[model samples]
Target: MKLLTIENLVRKFSLKVLTGENQLQQTITQSRSHRPGLEFVGHFDFFPTERVQILGRKEITYLHKLSIEERQIRIGNIVKYHPPCFIVTAGQEGLTYLTQYCVEEGIPLLCTNEPQTTSEFITKLDAYMIKTLAPEIAIHGVCVNVYGMGILLRGKSGVGKSETAHTLIGRGHRLVADDIVVLKKLSPRTILGTHDGKTKEFLALRSVGLLNVVRLYGRKAFQDETRIALDIELTKWQKNSLNNELEHEPTFTEYMDVQIPHIEIQLQPGRDVAGLIEAAANNWLLKQQGYSAAEEFMKRLESDSSW
Candidate 1:
């Protein structure tokens, strides 16, 4: 696992570090080799040597109850602790001495403006941390990386996601995974999709059996990892279902507290599903940069008022 530094945290949250600029940056930038000790206190952990330490307003008061020497010792241990960085919730300011110690020792302090209880803050922060720190794995399925966007194909057995992926592959797009895709929630708002290393470069065609796609299609046809930008599901058409009036616009699928753009392409006789999927992918790419063809068409029709 790559330990994230405090400087990166500051950049990520757009926070202003009030003190200990130089030291905090240096301490957080270093790699963490071991896990920190955990001492649970009021929905927060007082880890002696973890890279990240969380401080609440009440926790700071609790620390003040200890002798000056003891407080110094504890703060020193945390400053030198090696998990990655420290996060302060609810914008609670620590004791002046503790803040001074943190500045001198170069320990990064992160503060959030969210006004929630300690437990709720911990739960949400932990979720965000896990997404940021978890490892990514790849699985079997057709993974398409189109113009910097990752589009995953998913559905029941024999749904045309894989076949559509193969078609995209033939059309000069890149593949990230085939069959099983290991998706990791990177943050509350982001999911990182990557190819499982042990099974990367492999795709199982329905009739042709397992094939080494990297070996057959060369390096350009495959990618080691990608951020899951969208999801497309291939489903059988239902006669009673209402078709989406918005063409070439992708929908979003929410999983594990993250929202990923997605689309459902109905499979039916005489429909060129592969071509539609490709067009969908292209249209999705355009939408990411604030262009929506369906919305544009509707705007034109509304403006004309004759159609």
Candidate 2:
């Protein structure tokens, strides 16, 4: 979604302008080309140089106290500042200079009952801007929220990524994204996971055709978004001469500049893949809480030597 524009701001906050229609129109036309829907507040006029002249309550009062020519100079100086809008709080105080300048320049002036309310309104506007402006990236995998941790499953076409996700779903995990995972960088190190709008709930279940998970499992059984914490890869075992090591516990691997805590489970003839995945999720939880089974075993061995 695009961010709110000056017109949107006026409509949302219900602001009443005291000056500058011509200026407002010109500024809106020019800013729309760049910001599109950026919301503006208060009453202001647009200068020829594409700047807005704001007429605040204090300035209006000052204009009332000054001579006619002095008031014109004040409004001119304000236009030179090139503000996008002018805000006159509370009610009208007969600041004819400000009103005339706004009428001539066509800038928007906004009036509101309370300043604090306006502050909150602007805060929400900023939040909306950030969410809409964030960069988005897509990855080929299925993401699920299992026991409050984001788990991403990746492998070859027939390597059972969706099947594993289904298994996890059946085991009471919440599905986030099915086939294509949309990842957004929320922070420097944190990546938030979501699905593209087109495929948010659509999942391919081999023989079952397309299935709507939300329709089947209810909304609570799935999350609209989550932060990706780990990645699991499934690979077919090759009986070649290489590093052959017995699987002791879960391990990790990295990909695409992300330290995706990974585990390559070799799919064999008679392995309980679903159960293994559950155990992997539990192991990840333990690791996150600083409990390592390998480290515990080493500690036990050292203690036994003293005995």
Best by lDDT: 1
lDDT of 1 by residue, 1-307 (tens): 3455567566665555665566445533222222223332212253335445566666666677878888777667656543345566556664577667667765555566657665566665555456556654444456778766788887887877777777777877788887777788665777777665666887777888887777888888888778887777888898978555666444578766688887777888788876887677677677668987777989999989975
lDDT of each: 0.66, 0.64
Supply the TM-score for candidate 2: 0.62
The backbone clash count of each candidate, in order, is 20, 31
Stretches of candidate 2 above 4 Å error? 1-127, 239-258
lDDT of 2 by residue, 1-307 (tens): 2343455545655767566444434323222111111122223343333322233444455557777776676566655444566555435467566666656655566665555443354454444444444556788888888878888888888787787777777888888898899876645566678888888877788877887888988876679888778777778877772354433544554433446677777777787876777787788788789988778887899999998
What TM-score does each of the candidates earn? 0.56, 0.62
